[model samples]
Target: MVRNSRILIVDDVVDNIRVAMNILKEENYEFSFAQNGGEALRLIFEVGESFDLILLDIMMPGLNGFEVCKKLKENPTTQEIPIIFLTAKVDVDSITQGFSMGAVDYITKPFHAAELLSRVATHLELYHSRELLLKHNINLKAKAKHEKNRLLSELEDSQKEMIFILAELMEATSDETGKHIKRVAETSALLAKYHPCLNDEDVDLLYHASPMHDIGKMTIPLEILHKPERYSEDEFSLMKKHTINAYSLLSHSDRKLIKAAAIIAHEHHEKWNGTGYPRGLKGPDIHIYGRIVALADVFDALTHKRHYKEAWKIEDAVAYVLDHRETQFDPELVDIFQEHLDEFITIAISQ
Candidate 1:
């Protein structure tokens, strides 16, 4: 496609320029000519992008074709412009040097007009085909990106449907209704929305993901999870196994949402001071998603009516969390939480 376009001829000899221009003219090909390497370099720099191919002479005064080709190769803007050497130099070393300096082909002097025309045509066709292949590659990348986004959107919708179903199953097993998990999910999303480190996507993921925090509880028997009395030592140990069960349930998937869900399931029960879980993970040992869900889950449990206890006042719930900052929560995260406490309460009340 590009070979059918403009070609530039560079040589100092007037007769040679006339002959080459005439040969190309009969085929209706457009062309430009420069007398010497210096003049050709100037013309190319000025309108280089328009020229598809060049016929270069190697024996010109003040910057020979080899020097010109070397200069063209140095300028990134003109480096890839193909050059065909039209010169008298026929020795093996000179021909090798022409290619080394970046000329695409060597055509010796006293040249046949037909051979020159045919070589020019072949190089131009190859250049145009390479351009077409590059365009196709760019289109392929864009199409692949579009398909990936579509698949991700479908997967997110499917995961939400599964979470809702799983939440219902958990509610069916426990004395507390599904509203508890729903409230926690809403509250966690609100907290993440106002958090400085989280973006809109992170907030949305946390919203859907936080509800699955107690999914491990599905493995705990109804007697331990729903009992209206304090748990015995053996029952408490079995109760703690819920975290591992939750991790097991969600860990095998490669999906990002499920991976996040697995992390929350395993670490939400972990305390900041290394004292409150089957693993006793401390401080940053807990992933940020787990820390965020921990605060949301505990706050909702404190402020909502439960089978075993009455709901505490909103102020009381806040005070309990603030007082136990380093012991129960990451101190730095608690500082961010305290700054956004009012908003958290508003979201809780609204929901």
Candidate 2:
């Protein structure tokens, strides 16, 4: 309905061109004419004159209307320009060929002025509306992608904050330092990266979740948690319940990181030989996340001085891990630990 819509008219006869222009002039459209199909193509292609609709005559000398329509439809730039065959060829074959060639409609030589105006207006409106819809869909998809990324970022931030807060609460009640938690997180992530079954995302999840392995220590009394001497039978029994306490506290969450933390907290103490506590799960029956963090937590704990024990030398810690393999730790995880020993040493020394 916008004023001054541009239209291209191609006809060998000057009268036919003039008639279409005259009939359409009252609609306030700008008109361009070509005597042959070649000129119409030149004006549309070489000259780059944009048009809303094209009124093509079928019987032109060079590059007849059908050929022009075919070429125009093949071109991506001009393909969407609506074309109406304005000619005297009213046979079924000619009409079928025109439609097949991508002409929007066909009009016999003497078109009614009212019909021409109505058809042109209808097709132009349809074309513009389609263009608007395509753009809207593209913008909607882009906005949805942006919103999804923003929400994911916020969720990840919240997970990290929750992990640190709970980990620090455990640290506050026990001898574990922030550095121990950091080293455990880094070592767990490093071990997960080299594990055959785990992917990068799994590595990241373990990295964040490993720090909460002792989150249950927050529930232990300071007398037991910070005891300077080895635990007696009853004291050790009560101490071992920290793992169950951590699982109980964390397993209620539906969040992935928290759920992974729950598994690590509960199973990090389990021995590969079924000598470990809580459920006596052994070997592959243990979750990989639990198996990975168990090794990391012990290695870091042994290298660092605790209230109950002096820090063993790094070499001694490594020997202890190798010695305890298959008894206290998963065999495969111990292999990973030995293979990546240098990296673990670097993380411990740096942190």
Candidate 3:
């Protein structure tokens, strides 16, 4: 007990409260008295935050101290207030019940003055210290969450910047604008949403990785890349190396986006029927990312003019894709592409 500290005494018997108050009145502590559990609860609800500690009597009329303690412990605001049970029984069961109901300590009736002061002082000190530690832990968790969100934002920006720069690098070989890469990425991501194999992470990785599908073209000679006529066999062989070159450029990194990009670059040229170049992988042998980028790249390339070819009509390009289903492209992917024709057209127009 200390000066200015509020203590509540709840007992049906007036003499018992008088005895406890007299024992600690010399210390200048403030006191409040209640005749039963109901009165104690009313006072607590009215001004529980003003109370530093409570000296409660277990045996009472109407509501018992155990019931009052349970109510206090269940409340968010009053739960932290230290409770000391004043019991006459001194039995193990009563004491266990008091502590179990969230009492900090229990004192037997006919209390000694020195013992009362010591227990009160110790519990008050422990309670306030625990409150300080709780506040610190809550603040620490808030700051940690804020820092985690900031790092994720930075990583997202880094991925976008890297995708943009690499896409431009690949398009520079043929002297075309980088919008082709952007359109391919958007189309690939849109088509991927229909895939059973891809989750959210897979969709995001494909969107970022698809832009690098033609990164191998950056290694090809400007003459071959921009030739007016069809490529000679030797020139075409050099040109076909772009896919392998793309894989080589991206395969060194273990990052999810880069690893997916490597696979796309490596197998995008492989045909569904084993006729296309590089590895000549067919059907399910090609990774899904590869198959997706292959469709995206060819679709965008056909609808737009290139150094070697004129742009085909949208209908003609789409018909060509349908004609080669399961031969030049994955069959299901072609179906999805046809199903979402309007969306692809809108993307082609917008991007």
Query: Which candidate number would show the highest lDDT if scored against the true structure?
Result: 2
Candidate 3: C-alpha RMSD after superposition:
5.5
In candidate 3, what are the lDDT values of residues 7-85, reduced to their tens digit? 8999999999999999988777789999999999888787543688899999998899999999989998888899999
| Prediction-by-prediction clash tally | 0, 0, 0
Q: Candidate 2 overall Cα lDDT vs. reference?
A: 0.90
Which ranges of candidate 1 are over 4 A from the true structure? Answer: 1-4, 46-49, 74-76, 196-204, 252-254
Candidate ranking under TM-score, highest first, comes to 1, 2, 3
Question: Can you write out model 1's per-residue Cα lDDT over 1-351, one digit (the tens) per residue?
Answer: 233467889999989999888877766678888999988888878654457788999999999988988988898877777899998878999999998888889888777988988888888887677778989999999999999999989988999878867977887788667787778888778777777788988888888877788888889888788788888899999999999999998999987788888888899989999987979998988888988888888888888877778889999999988998999987876787798888778765665
TM-score of model 3 (CA atoms):
0.72
Q: Using lDDT, rank the candidates from best to worst.
A: 2, 3, 1
Q: Estimate each model's TM-score.
A: 0.86, 0.74, 0.72
**Can you write out model 2's per-residue Cα lDDT over 1-351, one digit (the tens) per residue?**
756889999999999989899998988989999999999999989998999999999987878999999999999999999999987878899999999999999778687988888998888888888888999999999999999999998998899887988798779787778888889999999999999999999999999999999998888888888788888999999999999999998899998889999999999988899888789998999999988888898999898988878899999999999999989898888999899889989987787
